[model samples]
Every structure is written in C-alpha cells, then in structure tokens.
Target: MTASVLRSFWIGGFEGADHVNGAGEPLDMAAATAHLELLNGDYLRAREHGLLTVRESIGWRLSEPAPHRHELARAVQVATAARRHGLQVVWTFMHYGTPPDVSLFDDGLVERFASFAAAAARALAPLHDEPPVYNLINEIGYVAWAASHTNLIHPYVGDPQGLGEHTEASGYDVKRRLVRAVLAGMDAVRAVDPRARFLHVEPLVHVVAPHERPDLADLAERIAGYQWQVWDLIAGRLEPQLGGHTGALDLVGVNHYHSGQWEAGTERRLRWHEGDPRRRPFGALLQAAWERYRRPLIVAETSHIGVGRARWLDEVASEVANARAAGIPVEGLCLYPLVDRHDWGDPAHWHHSGLWDVDHDTPLPRHRRLVPDYAAVLTQWQARLPGAPPLPIAPPVPEPLPESRANGVVPCTT
Candidate 1:
C-alpha cells in the first residue's frame, strides 16, 4: 500500500476551494463548477483524455463542521469515485477554509487539524491499494498572505469586507502556525496509516524590478526568494521550532499560473506571451525547485482563462517536457480547475479557464462542453509524454472565438 507511482504524466485538478470570500460568504468552487454533481462524467472524461491522476481536496468546514466532531461522507464519496474510475488521487486536507470556531492564530488550531486529518485518513485509506498522496495544506503561502497579510478570506483586516492594509508581522505568524498545523496533521495521518505520502504544495513565482524602479532590485530579489521559505521551513533549514525535517518534504508541488511572474510592488504583470526578458522560463523554475529540494516535483496547478487556455497548455506542457529531458524529475502536470469556475468575489463572473466550459442554461450537473482548442493542445502534448495513453480519436476542430471574449471576461486573481 506504500508504493509511489503515477500512471500518467498528466493530472486533472478539481477546483475544491471551500473558503469564505472577502464578502464573508462561503464559496465552494467544486459545487460552483458542478464537479461534485458531475463527478462520474468528469472522471471518465479525464481518463479518456489520458489524465490518470487527479488532485482533490476535502472541505475541512464540511468534514469537520463542528469542533472535535467529524463527518467524512463526501470525502469517502470522492475516494470511491476515484477508485471506481481507476484514477490515482492527490488529496488536500485543508484548502483555505476551516471550521468557523478554528482560528489560524489559536493554539488549538494545530490539534484540531490533526484530529480531523486522522479521522479523514481512517475513513478513506482502505479504498486504495497503493499509498495515497495527501497534501496537508494547499498553497500555504497564499493562504497565509490572504488570511493575515491582506484579507481575501477570513480574519478580515479592517472592516467585515476584508479591505485594509497588509500586516507584515501577522503574515509571518500565520505562516508559522500553518506550518505547525501541517506538521501535526502529517504525524496524525501517519499514525492512522503509515503508507500515506505527503505533498508540500506552494506557489512558484518569479519577481522582477520594474524598469523605473531599479533601486528596488534587492527588494524584488527578496520577494522572489520568499517562494523557497516554506519548503526550507518544512526541511528544517529554517524555523526548526515548527517541527520541520527532511522527511516532511515528500513530493514538492508547485502551483504556477500565467500571472505568476510579475513586476514587484506594481500592478504590471510580466508578460509571458511577449518577450519579457525579465520573465523566467517555466522549465527553469522547475529546475530551480528540483535543485533546491532534490525531490520529485509536480506542477500541482496551472491554467489560463478563455482563448489563452490552449497556448498556456502548450507552453506548460513544453516546459515540462524540456525539464524531464534535462533530468528534472517532474512527475506530472495538473490542469487545474479541470472545469471552469465562477469567481469567488463575483459569482456572476465565470472564468473560462478549464479544459471544459460550463453552460449556464443547464440545470444542476450542468453541461460541460470540451474546449476543442484546449483538447487539441492536450492531445499533442500527451503524444509526446511517455506513459500517456493515446486518444482513440482526434480532438474536434476549435471554434474561433474573439480574444476579448475568451481572455477578457474578467481580470485574473490568485
């Protein structure tokens, strides 16, 4: 039950972020995207497209709706569905949202999270024959930055709307607490099932000095350097009090997006399409992560909205291929939000960022129409990667759509 292996190089990620938004309303991306209701079809399509592995998450708020009490019916349902589809799962225990009573700054957060983790592990472990991968927390840096620094989620800054200045000190505090919670949760899960494998997922980004702000070069470098802090902490290279050690850093999961590269301290994003020399190659980022931790890497999350989706897939897939050729052990690339989602801040706004777009007119389990262009790009890349099953038929021809409609529906965030 402890064997470590991935059936294919490609993985699909269900958008399972169940967090309270800036407006103080709970948002469930999986339900918004209809992934839960359409679970069977989604998995069948993923396997059909050669995506044999998937990234999934348990809604902590739902699983542990109350303090010290646990209910994992949905968690078991997802595990059963994955097993039935013959897919391997990468389970995320905490995805930003937690029980309302649990506070990030509280001493009890660590213990509460550990208890919930052990409960979930016991409930789901028997479904799989091989060791199941578990990500204790998804995007630790982003969660900290949101909850403490800025306030995109809970622990709002000034007013209830969560609009206010960033707290530098609070940011560090939240990060450490989150790390400790992960360590504790890992130990608990291991106690329940020793075969469990852990994945440390963090955002991978590059920062550069704006041409006008040459004086801020060092600051920009420091910002870019922050990406490694969490991994270091997990490996006991930093903040040894958090109970971090080498074994805690199992599989390194990096979440990168089109907006991942940017000009430090400014609104300008370093253009990936344009020849922004400041922009680093995706392969280089992967190589750097591998060199730093020397662990098997996974592009845990990556996708672009609208018309940019196909091109983004092509670029990411190419970079992954190049990295593997250069001997970087990138186990897989997950096309996240496998289905398009409605924005958390604005539910009316939909980001056509997934391989399949949603039709609003349809009922619960809405219609999922595959984006022909994206499918074509995926098919091309799957043929190049080893272990990917060949598609039985060619992807449909893409329907031409205006770039404005495809990419400009709404400004990208997160």
Candidate 2:
C-alpha cells in the first residue's frame, strides 16, 4: 500500500529580525514586506509543485515591543498572504529570540511572553478558526547551548573564566523559565482559541563521543534533559528537583540539521557532519521522539550547509516514510529557507542552501536548472514511485542559465 503525502510550507523568520543577525535588531517594515513577497512567491512556486502547509513564525520580540503595545501588522500581512495562496500555516510563537529587554531567567519575562502569545492568538484567530499550531520556542536545547556552552548568541561569550561561573546553573534556569513562559503563553491563547495546539521544537543531539570526565557526561545528560524534560513536564511526570511544571508540550517538532552531531571532551569537539545514507541519525531522532513523547512529530528544519540539500531532503523524506510505516504519526516536513537567504548578519555572502540558487546580480533560468544534490533527490524519489502524481508545477520563475549542461546529479559517496 502507498503512503499518503502531507504537504506543508514554513514562512517568516523565527524572530522577526534576530534570525537575520546574531545581534537583535527590529526588522525593517518595508524590507520585511519585500522578503514576504519573495516568500509568497516561493509558496506560489511550491504550490504549483504540490505543497499545502506552510509554517511561519510570530516572533515575541516583534509582537510586543513594549509590555502592552503590540505590533503585528507585518506578521498579519504574511499570514494573510499565505492563506490566500491556499496554504495552512503553523505559527511558531517563539524561535530563539525574546524581547531584547526581557531576560529568560526573569519571572516577569514569562508572564509578559504569555500575554504576548495570547494577544497574537487573539489577533490571528479571526483569520482562521482552527487556531494556528504555536511552537513555543524553536530548539530550546540549542538556545541553551548558545547561551551556556558555545556562546554563539546572547548572555554568554564562551568566556573560559566564565565557564565555571554559573554556566550549568544559569543554563538550566533559563530553560525552565522559558518552558514556563511557553506554558503561560499557551494558557493565554487557550482563552481565545481553545482548539489551539502547542508545538515544542528542539534539536536532537547525537553524542558521538563522551568526555573522559564523569562530570562532562553528567552535563551532557543534563543538556539532553532539556529535550525530554519539557515532555515530562507537560505529561505531569517531571521530578520536583528539576522544578518542573505541567503542560509544556502538545506536539513535538524536531529541527535536525546535518550539523547536529556532538563530541564531548574538555576541548569541546562538536562538529556537524553529514551522515552516511545507511546510518542517518534523523531516523533515530524521530524514533526516539516517538518512544519518548508519543505525540505528532514534524521535521521543523532539516537541510545541509553549502550545496548538499537535495541528498539531504531525499534521505530525510525516505526516513519519514520508514517511520510512518512503523506507526509513527509523522505529520509533515518543511523545507526551510524556502529560498536562499543572505547570511544571518552578513547580507553580502549567500548561504547557497536553497533548492534554487539566487544571484543578486542577474536573472536565472527556471527549468532544466537544478542544484546537483537536489536533482539527485528528485530523480530518486521519481524512480522510487514512477506513477506518483507530479507535484503541481508553478509557472517557470526566471533563473540564470547553467554554465554547464549536466543533467545528472551525483549521489553522495561519503
């Protein structure tokens, strides 16, 4: 028997402007509108190709710039455009960036966030009745890692001296506080849209190596705790020592990038490596999530850095199919960055990870043009199901003609 495919789309940045830069800045309204136009065009393109659901974000930082004042005109425009294109949106309320003035550790922050989430739901409820699925935060585990260990983001700078300075304590505290804030936010939304559902997104960690020190192992366990802890909290199974609360997750969203593998030691040998097709970790992550949470799961973000996206998507789609055959309720998968985006903070350099490559300088061709890796997935999936319905085709968008006429894509041998 053939499995049914669930189509979906992801729109907007996690936090309005923060997603574009490590430094939190308010997104320019005009520029943001133009970006939305690009996103809408991508949706129209994808729709022509056969996708139905698009997940977009409602950033806390952008929604409520101040305690009571709400700013949602931009988000509304995006959401409305998405609905017009006949797409279902899964609204992610928080994706890593909170209001600049709010500290994750503050109780006030939690209350304020809850209020903001409630406000957002109220504003958006009229557009659709099936209250949007609210992802409380994106990758809480990664957020904690950024603030506590890697110092890639705010509040921490990876200071060696500060390493011993409340790193673990502060990290855990911030995580717990954020979860509470999410719960509060959900409660507020329920007041407006009782049918609303919650989505908890986190990175799945594959510990490749454990450090020699038992303490390091314990720390790793604690970090892993962040993933399961919210589930436990919501299911009313959290230990008192963890300062747990009830009702933190309703759905599970896993963001599995190729770079999620980790190695532990004092030197911190964490590196993101593409896995062999025969041993993909994304499957393990989904299986683990099913065993642990038993909730609906979605691949929130799964792509590779540079130009290997096609193979990455094929492997991920196959894994999803396998998991579904095994009775896992794998609801949907979203291809992130719908189009290639400029580097987070540095707009000059392109990430080159989109299905279609973008050159700011010139026009590009639409058909007979495929990224090698993406083309591989397209061929494999087609071969796997020769009679499958073709994805709805969007009118050909312009693309630069390929310098070479190669039509075949190389499968990854590594």
Candidate 3:
C-alpha cells in the first residue's frame, strides 16, 4: 500500500511555543510538558488512543544556537520516539523561537533560515523512511503581529523613532521578512529532500463590528484579511511579490480556537459558545478556506479552557465530519497541547485545556494527568472517524495513584 500522508484523521500536538516571557525569561514548552524525558510514553499514550499522527517542534534556539552549527539531539529523540511507537510526526522547524543572534528584520534572515532548514533536513533524514512533513514556522502572521504590533517580542512601539507601535503599519516589515524566510526555507529543504511536504499554519479568526460601531465593519474585514496574507503571497495571489507561484503551497494548516472571533474596532473577544449570534459556524469557515486555497486543510490547533473543553471537541468533530462529507478535502483535526501547558506570561494561570491536564505549579514534567472528561469525548469522536482503528487496551498501572499525579494518558483514562 502507498504510504499515507497522515497515519489517522485525528492527530495530537505538543505545545511547542518557545517564546520569551514578559519578565525576559525564556519559556520552553518541551521542558514544561516533560516531553523529552517521557517522550516514548507520550507517543505510546497517543498511539493507544488511536492518535497515530503527532505534531512537535524542534527548538531553533536550542538546536542551533548559532548559524551553520547544528544540533539534532532533541529533534532526533522526538523522531526516534515517534518511529518506535509507529507514529507519523508533523515537525515544526521554528515555533516562534529564533536564535538570539538572528534578527527577523535583518537582510540575511532568509539566507540564515534556509541554511538552518537544510541542515535540519539533512540531520532528520536518517529516521524517516519518507519525506517528512513540516510546519516551517508556526503562525508567522501572528508572530509578526506580536513582534511589531504588541509588546510580545522586539521592535517595541515605545522605541525612540516615534513609530506607531501597535497598528497595521508595523506589520509590513515583519510580515514581508517572514514570507521571504518561508520561500527561501522551502527551496533549501526541497534541495535536500525532493518529496518534503510543508504546511503553512496560521490562526483563523473572525471579526465583527460592535453593535454601536457598525461603521467599523470594514476595519474588521481588513484585519481578518491579515490571516490570508501569508498564504496569498505563497499562492502568487499577492501582487508585485517574488518567488510565489501556483504550486508553492502544499497544505493549509489553520490554527483556530474559541477565542478566534472578536469585535473589529474594539477587538473584544466574542464567546464562541452560548449561542452567540455573531459567531460563524466552523463548517462554513472551513468551506470558505477551501474555496479560496483549493488545498487540503487541517485544524492544526484548537482547544477550550476549563469545562468547555469536552463540549468544544465534540463540536469540532461534527464540523470536520461535515466538511469532509461535503468534499472539502479536509485532512485532519489536531488536539493541540495534547499535554496541558502553563500560561506564557502568568505561570499561575492554568488553561486546563489539554486531553492531559498537567500540573504546571511544580517543577519538572510536573504531573501529566489525563482529563477523563475530555479523553472520553475524544475517544468516542475517534471511533466515528474514517479509517480509525480500535483503540489498544491500556496496560494497568502498578497501583492506584491520586488522579492529580497520574502518569500516562490512556492508563489514566480508566
């Protein structure tokens, strides 16, 4: 049989956003999730739950602190664990974490990124029997907006130039650089592995004019268009741009969440549930995305915090099924942060959003316990998927431990 692009329709992703926090402390999710230490167990847990495809990030800063000099220890461990557990991994080359020395606005950023990609491809080739799938940079559009528009990264608005800090104007420079880096990185990776596939993952959002500010509808629509700019440039739809052609894009990996929709002028987040009239149906948005790009798509990232978690997953499964039946060519739905993660800015705030609820208070992989409510819903959803296999029976734990300190995902579900 020909090798499948993804092992199954339902996939799981580790939250690998390696960004600098507000206090200038580095936040490494790989460390937070206890991924490297229990990497095999995590893969095993996903496999038993019938999630054979996993998404993970290889930290750019940790892997290659300097240009040209590459380190593949972490990436290799992740790949090896997946291979051993019979899983297909969606590797992300850069998850919002760039080396300290590499500046996003510098002229040579593209070249440096391409070199890094080529080095990574060469290093990862031995583990994979086929061309590996990659999300080159997780949500570059968001990254650009955060860096230029918000106080997230460098080039803050408070700089001495009197530049308009948090507006659309700041996005031009950073967005262009991100596009160039992707275009250059694609060429470099393809040079090493001809069959390599890429996913341009961007956050999908909806904007509505506030009741009192109907005139702001246009502004909301314009901001919504920002989501498509990166894909547009790659598809040759953006005019006066270079290196973009019809087939430049391979897949559309959209990262969406309950908070995606918001007021246009005021930017107030609209509640996705509770029958909000302004909220658009997920299937409708998926259809729109398909009509525009004409490429296979995946819900790359999605989850809700607290009790809304199970309800959200059920809704997403229904939408994905509807889209597939309607011939949208929808590939998969990934449960992002399969292992729970802590807040980037405030460590005290736990999202409680993962199938596995991890304890972020204690240091070291802390405790990754299964959220029984969410896992049950996920298992049922998987059974209804096309080509989904029977979930393997989990091995019994030596003794009953408190729910707070459960070790593996599947075993904890009992």
Which candidate comes out best when scored by TM-score? 1
Compared to the true structure, candidate 2 yields what TM-score?
Answer: 0.76
Cα deviation of 291, candidate 3, in Å: 0.3
lDDT for residue 280 in candidate 1, whole number 0-100 = 90
Ranking by lDDT: 1, 3, 2
lDDT of 3 by residue, 94-123 (tens): 888788788776756777777888888887
Q: Looking at model 3, which ten-residue stretch has the lowest summed lDDT? A: 405-414
Report the lDDT tens digits of candidate 1 across residue range 375-403.
99999988787443222222122223234
Q: Judging by lDDT, tell me the better candidate of 1 and 2.
A: 1
* Candidate 1: segments with Cα more than 4 A from true spot: 1-4, 158-170, 362-365, 387-414
Question: 230 in model 1: Cα distance from truth in Å?
Answer: 1.1
For 128-245, candidate 2 gives per-residue lDDT tens digits of: 7444677767666556556665445555454446543222432555666666566556667777787676767776655433445655766655545556665565444754332233
Best by lDDT: 1
Instruction: Evaluate model 3: give its lDDT.
Output: 0.76
